[model samples]
Target: MKYAWAAPGAKVVCVVPLGASHDFGIAIDTVMTIAEVDTSPLVKCSVILRFQERPSDCWYAAEAFRPIISQDDDVAMFKAIADRGLAQNGIHVPSSSPEHA
Candidate 1:
């Protein structure tokens, strides 16, 4: 699941479990803003929240926040993070993969 399109003025929202609805809760919260579109298209941002269920519910999730980025920047950020993650897990990633091959 990818959400690398939360640009400034972009239409985006969060989904939560129902039944435990809240009367007072922030809907949209943005933590970080990508300054350079050329350097980091998918900038890392987080969301802090105080839920009604548990105190441990205060959590932060990293996101590939994109804001009016170019093709090169988009590809670069994705590829860089992909490479790092794969390499960290001792996995060798090819330049391209086959269709379910």
Candidate 2:
């Protein structure tokens, strides 16, 4: 959930505010850049994101966005799925097996 690693071109899910109904949803966008503004004694940073479906840029706090699945995370998820498939087929997969040395 760390936004520090996010850079330009990185995909992120932005939280959208919904009023009254309290229904909240997320919008996926690509990171444009991080903007820093100096306010006298304080410096504020905002994440600039661009929507994929349209031509628009949104500036929001860094906390409002969450990183999408990373390459390592995808690999681990696929490995888990493969392990489950093997188990379902009566094949044994060691829980602590190393995929690579």
Candidate 3:
């Protein structure tokens, strides 16, 4: 998995993944999951990264989200998603993902 720095205090959607390399900076924070973009509908236990930890806000999107990231590693994860045509969009990686989602 690849990671980008998030600006301190910048709110982001964390994509918590199972059996993946986890982000060491946000391993024990609590976040809220919303079902919709503007709605605050509670979804699941979401974790937020601590601004004090790795405070450099950067959106982690599939290589499709160019200008933000690139598809370098063959197993970059985003590659497979792009292959399936499931390009755009990213999941919030809660601090609990086995690894950086």
Candidate 4:
């Protein structure tokens, strides 16, 4: 999601990753996921980062989309993703996944 906002009174802030479709594989994200510290709520029971395409504003909060993926460590999760992106281009990304993706 390119942008995110709470439900006005919700304490749980979500990490929304804004993305868009590209010529590659299927979806090519132009920018990385954005997590606002001041407005974003702490990691909680229900939190999901959805890919909100451009010109679209439809979004919602989710507890769990499916029976897969545990977002216990969001930083690690996204860091791995970034690492893969960097490795694909022979770039070094600091963190867990230092080697190739």
lDDT of 4 by residue, 5-94 (tens): 322222332334323344221122233221222224664534433333322233333431212233776667887798789899999745
Candidate 2: C-alpha RMSD to true structure equals 9.7
lDDT per residue (tens digit) for residues 1-101 in model 1: 24455333333233432223564332443233322112234534442222223243443232322234568988999999999999999998766657645
- Global Cα lDDT for candidate 4: 0.38
Better of 1 and 3 by lDDT: 1
Q: How many backbone clashes does candidate 2 have?
A: 0
Q: lDDT, candidate 2, residue 52?
A: 44
Best by lDDT: 2
Report the number of the highest-TM-score candidate.
2
- Return the lDDT, model 3, position 91: 48
Worst 10 residues of 2 by lDDT: 34-43
Q: What would you estimate as the lDDT of candidate 3?
A: 0.32
Write down the TM-score for model 3: 0.17
Model 3 lDDT per residue over 32-79, tens place: 222212112352322223323332452222211111223474356665
Badly placed stretches (over 4 Å) of model 4 are 1-72, 94-101
Model 2 alpha-carbon drift over 4 Å, by segment: 18-42, 45-58, 70-72, 77-101
Better of 2 and 4 by lDDT: 2
Q: Which stretches of candidate 1 lie over 4 Å from their true place?
A: 1-67, 97-101
| TM-scores, all models, native as reference | 0.28, 0.36, 0.17, 0.24
Ranking by lDDT: 2, 1, 4, 3
Q: Give all candidates' CA lDDT scores.
A: 0.43, 0.52, 0.32, 0.38
